[model samples]
Target chain A: MRFQLALAACLLTGAAHAATDIDLFFPVSVQGKLANEMARLVEVFNKDHPDIHVTPVYSGSYDDTNLKTHAAIQAGKPPAVVIMSANFVREYVISDEIVQLDPLIEKDGMTEAAFMDQFWPALRLNATEDGHAYGVPFHNSTPLLYYSVDAFKDAGLDPDHAPVTWQEWIDAATKLTKHEGSTTTRWGLMMPGTYDYCGWITSGLAMSNGGEFYNTGYGGEVYYTQPSTIGAVRFLDNMVHKAKAMPEGVTDTNAVTTAFFQGRAGMMILSTGSLSFVRDNMKTPYRTAFLPRSLVNAAPIGGASLILPKGNSPERQAAAWVLIKWLTSPEIAGGWSRFTGYFAPRIAAYDLPEMKTFITAHPDAKVALDQLVYARGWFSTYNVVGVRKALEDGVQAVLSGRATPEAAMAKAQQEADALMRPYVEQTALKVPE
Target chain B: MVALTGTTERPVIRTRVRGRVRPWLTAYALLLPSALFLFGFTYWPVVQVIRCSLTVRGFRGAAHWGLQNYARLFNDRHFATAVVNNLIYAAGTIIPSLVLALLFAVALKETTRLTSVLRTLVALPMLIPLVAAASLFAFIFLPNAGLLDHYLAKIGIAETNWLGDPSLALGSIIAITVWKNCGYYMLFFLAGLAGIPQDLLDAAKIDGAGPVQRFFRITLPLLGPTLAFVLVIATLNALTQVDHIIVLTQGGPSDATAMILFYIYQQAHQNFDVGMASAATVVSVGFLFALSIVSLRSLERGIHYET
Candidate 1:
């Protein structure tokens, strides 16, 4: 009778603890190596929690990931979790396609506000909407000025004292630029002018010029024609057309990085997420600094966040929550941060001994973390991609010497306003009267 | 006697009609599976796209039928730019590539081992996937450190921002398209050249016609149908292929290289504007259909099946 009882208890335990399988759609925006790291991390997670099996789906870029997530939701087979571009979270919320994390936080015996306090204050605006958390901050990044130490010294500028103001920044670029007759052998600076990166770096410039590139609280308005934005465009125009310190027209991220690695470019403004890639590939000594200020120092936060998509079963969601919590925990987050070059979003991740040692050894990452004080929310609004493209088009026009800054900004504002018309009509423009 | 003969004839006619209807029924029964798939996959999606294009989808409310999406598309400057750019792309890629394919086919018409090796060499670019080729050329076109620039520097040419400049970016993309597609079309031309009878060429030669004259008067006319078919295929390819665009440029540098399909993809995937994307799709399909009809009609006049 005792043997039979033991057998029955073992069967009951096995039945109760069947594994719950869930998919986590993740995008590899920075590099392909991070995709492998993500898979390894998922394997570790699966090994640690045998009852909750998480499969990491390698989604494409941020835009492609957004597309896949929406396509999955439409097909009524939504993934349990997605590491979405943080700005796209609002659109997901607006479409009622994502689950709010407030209740999940509350169920964990903590209030939403208390749970959110674990992340940096700069990340809150993009992570939350209407005081409710929809996204958990994952790895995050801010733009940093990555310059070659050798180039700085060769240009007769102090490598230790990096440019801190717009004037000094232009002067340094001019000094660093190398010319062979009418041909430019090396450009002074290069920034990615691709779709998403273009808008990001441009917004950083606008914000540093004391402008809110777009309204953070609302999703229907942008300040494209504002003075600060005009000034930012003019600054880029000066660098490209007048000073000839930068290349005319648009250069992609890979091209920019290739130029920098080949010593064809002296300086570049790139995301902190590229730190690992640069450190791994670059043979020469390099250093990082804050983005130069015009009216003030400013940079926009970038990178993805973990969120629960809608249309999952309660059991599956519970499993996903377990995965999310485990992934965002200090050790895992810090490990991922170190591997991917993004700063850990969880504040406690920085306190880990390994993390502390890593930061001490890599001062470039320290500069990225230091820039967080000036970090602002990325430009996210209704029809975010379209609205952002309007500004990108304008900046590109100016960069290629096709239009003046004022004209470009005016056109951008008009186009952006047109894109947001539907949302604006429903909310801001809908008067009670 | 007349009534009995009429009754017999009527029965025979009925039997003949029944025999004809049975075979048609059997044939249609055999065709039903393919017809069902054709409707389900092709016709149904097209009908749905037209329906979606005529409706307005909002985040909160029910989608209502309207023409606003079409209106928005017409007013969009980017769409206009894409249309103009696609035209230039089609013209730039189609003519040069077709000419190159013809030249290659004529040069290597023989089936000797050396000719086969040369043919393989000429057709090599067709083997690489468009995405891989685009990536390879993206590096090749890089400003200062690219393969092209490095070689050109020896000839006293300065560095050029091939993919960055608005004016040059489309041309660079066209160059890649020409390189990739010329080889594929050359294969089709080789088959067409093989079909042309050597006896006719020998006869032309006996009449003291030179190679160029024989090519123009005999081989060219014989290859007319093949050219027409290849032209249609090439035109369709020029309009449809956007993989390279996505890999190299996502329609940037002030929308200089934005093609129609890329614009539609951006709207549907990136922006999530279903109505606008559907409208754009409908317009594109209409354009493609019209172009196919016009090309087929005009090219039919020049086609000859026999020597």
Candidate 2:
């Protein structure tokens, strides 16, 4: 009788503390250690919220995470939450595969605008659609021009003043380039020419050249063939073919980082997310600056955002919301920002004592944050990956000396239009005749 | 007496017929599990993919049954480039690797201690996973600071972009594939060489045939069956193994190394165009099926086997 009573008590306590189990799908776009950090964060959340159990899944790169999330939804096992690329949130919203966060926020007795005001304004554009919130800005980044101070000094260029315009940028690169016989010992400039990175940097250049790159309000159009965009492409073409300051053909993120670290690349344009990695690995002194401008100082935002995928139970979603809130809270957000090189999306994160101290120490990170004044939304569309690849292909062609900038941009524009034709027909072109 | 005999014979014949039917039923019952598995896992998915290829999705309106996906494939320059690239990749990887394997098998057939150590050294690359090998090679192929360029520079050679250059990218990948697979194929060739009767070689030696002559006259002909099997396997691998591509190039420097499977993957996963992906899948599988059938048939007829 005593044994049975003890068993009943144990069962009662177990039933009382039953937790809602949910999975958080995250992608490791930077170093692999970030995945471990993510798991540790989830562990802390689970400890604090005894009623929720969050399992962190290390999904692959941004593209792979998108694919996995879609596959899971189709397979009837959608993850409760996902940290997706900021640009891809638009596609998910269009396909109705993600839950809008407005209702969830309103349930907490707050207006959507008040809640969204917590994040940077530039991030707000990508996180919401048609006046409804779909994603919560977790971490955000803008492109920064990273240059080796040692190389600058070696080239006899002023290390105190980085290039502020495209012409100066080219001149600095040409001066920084080193040659031994027929071989180039050090390249002037290098940027990641692989798929997602290529499109992002290309769009940044276009925006800096006074072009919108793509229609911000619509999902079916791009300005690839516009004069501003063509000018951007021509600039990159001249870097490769005319000035011969950059390497010809495609280079991936790893190669670019490797070259930068080894001082084989005097300067490079890379995302701010790589700041921490660079700080840890680069032995030489380096500095960061805003991307060189053609007509305007502009940089495209690139990073991931926290989202709740559709097709989850109410209880699971509630549990996920708790996790997201905990993650985006100022203390945790600031900690994550310091751990990663990404500037925290929440404006309050910067006001924290720890974040302020970190910024004071890492002036390069401050340059990234300062560039936010010129930050713009990433290029998002109905089929973002396909559309982006269309432009990437053209840019790669021009870099490889295969086609002229004009011809490449025209071809890219045609391909992007064809890819978005179905969406165009359903939305913009479906007007009353 | 004759009527009694006929009745007895009729009962025996009936028993015989029943006995035959029972064994046939047992045979089918034994095959049921594997047959079900093949249909469920293999044949069913193929049928579904073919059906999916015929239906258009994510178009201007709701999906409908049509062949528009196939029509789209014809106009896709990327798909065309992938097909041509795959052909070149197959040709580039298979022939050189096969010749190398054959040479290694002949050179190392004696099984001495030195040969054993040499064989292990040759087979070392096969032991590493393709993804890991590709990553290692990525470092080795780095333009200026990489091992290859560093060594080549000492010899007065200029730096070359191994993976970044479109003209050189596919060739570099093929070289890795060849290095990875030569030893694996060599093992099969060794097995085939062992199966060849030593007396035939001894007889050729007594007849004044040189080593090369004996190899051509006896060894090459005898190794035909093994060659055919290995060829089929290499072809399948050429179509299926894309982990290296994913790691190294991702079909770029202008889609220079894009293979059929990678193209299908991009269409399905990246673009979410299921119809286009399914159509590409059907074409690739169909090509594989037809090539296998034709090669196996021709090889079976042309080759001779000793009992």
**Chain B alone, TM-score of each model?**
0.92, 0.93
lDDT of 2 by residue, A1-433 (tens): 9999999999987885589999999998975379889889988898898899888998999888999999999999999999999999999988889999998999999989999999998899899888889999998899899999999999999888999999999999999989989898788999999888899999999999999998887888999999989999999999989888999988888888999999999999999998999999999999999999999999999898999999999999999999999999999999999999999999999999999999999999999999998999999998889899889889998988898999998999998999999999899888987
| Model 1 B-chain TM | 0.92
Worst 10 residues of 2 chain B by lDDT: B1-10
Error of 1 at B206 (Å): 2.4
What are the clashing pairs of model 2?
Answer: none
Q: How many clashing pairs does model 2 include?
A: 0
Candidate 2 ranges beyond 4 A from true positions: A1-17, B1-17
Fnat per model, in the order shown: 0.63, 0.61
Mind giving the per-residue lDDT tens digits that candidate 1 earns over B106-198?
999988999899999889999999999999998999887889999988888988888888889999999999999998999999999999988
Tell me the whole-model lDDT of each prediction, alpha carbons only. Answer: 0.91, 0.92
Residue B80: error of model 2 in Å?
0.7
Question: Could you give the DockQ of candidate 1?
Answer: 0.59
The number of the candidate with the highest TM-score is: 2
